[model samples]
Structures are given as C-alpha cells and as structure tokens.
Target: MAEGGQIDTDILSDEAFDVLCSMCKNQGKNTEGEQYCVDCKDYFCVSCVKVHSKVPLCAGHKVLDKSQIKSRTSKGLPRAPTERCDRHSHKHIDMYCQKHDTVGCSTCMAVDHRLCKDTFYIPEFIQNNTYQVVATREIQTKLKALDTILAEKADRFKQDKQRLLKRKAEILADIRKFRQEINDHLDKLEKSSINEIEDKVKSLEDKIKDSLKQLQANKSRITSINDKLTSTNTNQSEVFVYVKMAEDAATVAYKYIDDSELQCTTEDIEYQPDITIPTQLEEKKTLGTLAKKHTKTSVSLFQI
Candidate 1:
C-alpha cells in the first residue's frame, strides 16, 4: 500500500502491501482482496478465503477482513509464512505431526509421518492452543535473519560468477599466447634450415664451375695441337713438339677429371623434417590441465 507516493511499511510490516487477491492473480484473475491470511502472507478474495478456511492447514491461521485492515495500527503488524516447504521445493507447508513434533508439507505426512498416531492438521493444532505474542515475534525474527542470510549468499554467488568469467578469459588468452610463441620458434627454425641448404648448394656449385673451366681449357689445348699436326706447311720437328705438348696436357686433364668426378655428378637436394616433433604433439592430450578449488559457506536450511 502507498500513501503520498511512499510505501506504508507500518501497516504491512516489512513487506509491500497488495490489495488484490494474490491467489486469484496467480490464476490470471484480478479480484479485490476481502481478507488477509497472516500465515500465508497473502490477500485473498471471498471465494479463496472460504477455501483457506476449509483447508485443515490454513483454517486456524490469523486473518483480517477489509474493515480490520483499514483500522489496524502498526503495533501488531501481521507475521506470515513464506509459504514454501523446505524439502519439497514445489510443495507448501500445510501439515503438523504432533507425534514427532514436526511440521511439513502433505507429502511428508504421507511418507514419513503416516505411522504417527498423534498427527494433527497445522491449523487445528494452532486452534487448540492459545495464541502467543512471543511465538509470532519469534517467527518474525527468524524470517528477518533468514532474509539477511539469503541476501548475503546471493551477492557472493554473483561475485563468484563474475570471477569465473574473468578466469576463463585469462586462461584462453594464455593458450593463444602459448600457440603464438610456438609458431614464432618454428618460423625461426624454418628460416635457419633454408639458409643452411642454400649455403651448401652454393658452395658445391662454385667448385663444379671451377672444375668445368679447367676441363674446357684442357680440351682447347688438345684441339690446337691436332690443327698444327694436320697443317701441310708445318715441319716435322714442330709437329713432334706440338704432339709432345698435347700428350703432357692429356695426362694433366685425366688427373683433373678423376679428381672432379664426384663434384660433377648430378645431385638433388632434399630436406628431411624431424618427425618426432609432430609425433610428440599428436600424443599430447592437452596443453595443460584446468583445475579448481571450492569452499562452501555453512548455512542453516530454512524450514516452514
């Protein structure tokens, strides 16, 4: 309820006041509130109040009609149930087992308290005993404490969620950094290998080119000697001298050709990569393992 655009907390205790029937509103109906159930913490229409009165659990609950609601002061603001069963999350607290001195939902009576001979409906039990102001105050105090504990837990859980998200982002970044580092190292190794191959091939090419030049020089000298011997104007002594020079040249060329044989052979260069690198990588299941440590806060479970 609001007055002058401000909530009237005194009239409704710590809760926001609603004039509509909560039960009807849940069923998608808009009905005016006729009565308020202090135990259920809900407003109800005339029809719903009748149902509430008939229920063994809610029959004896403290209620206020519309006239009483308007006249009641802040001194005795009603205390009501939060209305959920602790064990059966979907069920509501609606029964009391006097034999075990326990209260729970109807399911609890059916399963665990069926054998108890002293069981009584929650409202019937309340009706049998005189209502005490101390009991209502005690219940209100517990509700306030529970609300505080739940609020703290909610805040902590939200903080933990944010922390987990941040941790995940950091881990992902580290993985990408590791991958980039490996790629850089491999790139350097590849460049060095290429340089080494080029250097060796260039050295071998220079040696082969030098050997070919010497062989060509020897062939030219032999051809010049043959031309001198075939000429009709050349004397016999000159021909003999030229033939002798050719024989000396042939012996030197033969020795050079034998020494250069391996250098002049056709060759193909190839690179053999280290297979162990890839093999080890394939054998690995992960870059690293992810782990977590958790600490649970002790909290007393709320019961109806």
Candidate 2:
C-alpha cells in the first residue's frame, strides 16, 4: 500500500491514521473549501452551492456562506427546553395559537395546537394591531407632560410663597413704626398737661402762705392792747381793739384732658394682594393603566 516504494505505515501510524481520517471527514477533501454542510457533511465551492433551511424538510432553506456555517450552527443550537414545539426543536415559537390564546412554533400549529385559527407571524400581528399601540403611546406621552408641568408649578409656588412672606414682613414693619409715632404723640400731650397743672398748684400754695402770715400779725397786736388795759385799771382810759372779719370763699378747679379723646383718630389701613393658586387636577387611573400596557407592549416588541 506504499505509493513511493516506502511502506504506508512509515508515513501513517495507527494513532496518526485516525487523526487524519477525522480531519478529512470534517473538511470533506473531495468537495473543496474549509467549510462543510451539517446534513451532507460535504464541502462545496462557491459556484456549486444550492439551498439551506431554517427548519429541515421545509421548502427553501437559507443559503449560507461556507465560512459562516459554523457560526450560524452555533447560534441556532438549542440549550434548555423552550416553549417551541418538541417535534421541531429547531423552530422557535413564531405565530399566535388562537385556540390556546398563546404563541407557538410551526410544529405546534401543525400538531398539538388544537383547532387554532387566526395564526400570524409576530411582526404581522404587531402591524395589524397598531391602533392599540398608538393609543397607549399617546397616554404615556401625556403622563410625562403632566409630570413636567407639576414640577414647574411646584417651583413657582415656592418662589411665590417666599415673595409674599417678604412683603408681609415689610408691611408689619411699617405698622410697627406707625404705632410708635402714635405713642410718642400721646406721651408729649400728657407731659405738657401735667406741667401746666403743677405750675398752677405752686402759685396757689404761695398765696396761702402770705395770708397765714398776715393773720398771725393781727393776733399779736390784739393781745398787746388787752395787756395794757388790764395793767392801767382805769375806766376813763380808752384801750380799743379793732378786729375786721369778712367771710370769703373761692374754689380752684382742675380738669384733665386725655390726648386720645381730644382730636386723635385712626384711619383703617388694609393691604391685600391678588393671589391665585392653581387647582390640582385629579389623576386619571385609566391613563396609568394605558401607560403600563404600552410599556409592556414595547418590551415585547424589543424582544421580538
């Protein structure tokens, strides 16, 4: 079995022979190129290619490049058990099973999916039911707009509250200053009235002191005359004591005047600013449900 007068065993040993055979099996030397088909286990040149299939035993299989075959096979291989039909493990659930109200693969449609109708591809189903999706999206947009408006309104409320408080403090300060001026005016009026009454009382006291001194002098003169008459003991000698008494009564009256009762009047002052607070709109529960439903639909579409 030597091609060049050397025994074939010299080039290939028992271990090396198996390795070479495996390499030939994988590469398919007769067909050419590095890639090979899984079903045919044969390599083919670019010009000699035919078709491939996503699901085996179906009409037209996807044509694949020789170089990309390995990557494709790796990607398409199944791992754990999926919702896809067991009969056709390679085919994913791609259509709605109307009988079960669920999605299923092609095999389920043909077999276990009983009495199923209105089956459609995932894309086709989404395309047909677009109105629901559009309505849901509109609700989500409105919710977002409401949230933004609420944020702005809250900021404005804070600013307005701060401004109003500042104005109120200023008004209170003005009121306090006005009150102080009124008190000062009352104090000055009362002080002037008290000083005038004190001056009048001092003048009356001086006049009463002079009248007492005059009465004391008259009493001394009368006593001296009586002593002379008693010492002389002569009836013919005339010793005369002259006394003049006039009853006179005069009343001094003091009247007090209150400054507040006189000419003082207060004017009512009122400060009012036009203020309007926005009423909070009631949150519609239906919109929230619509938003959530649309979010789920979007996630499902992304997965597809």
The model with the greatest lDDT is: 1
Worst 10 residues of 1 by lDDT: 295-304
Model 2 lDDT on a 0 to 1 scale: 0.31
Instruction: Give a tens-digit lDDT track for model 2, residues 171-260.
Output: 445434433443343344334333433343334334334433433343333333334334432211111100000000000000101221
| lDDT for each residue of candidate 1 in 42-96, tens digit (9 for 90 to 100) | 8899999998889998855756666545433352332322345657765545455
* C-alpha local distance difference test of each model: 0.49, 0.31
Residue 70 Cα positional deviation in candidate 2, in Å, after optimal superposition: 39
Those runs of model 1 whose alpha carbons end farther than 4 Å from true positions after fitting are 1-96, 103-127, 184-285, 291-304
Error of 2 at 167 (Å): 1.0
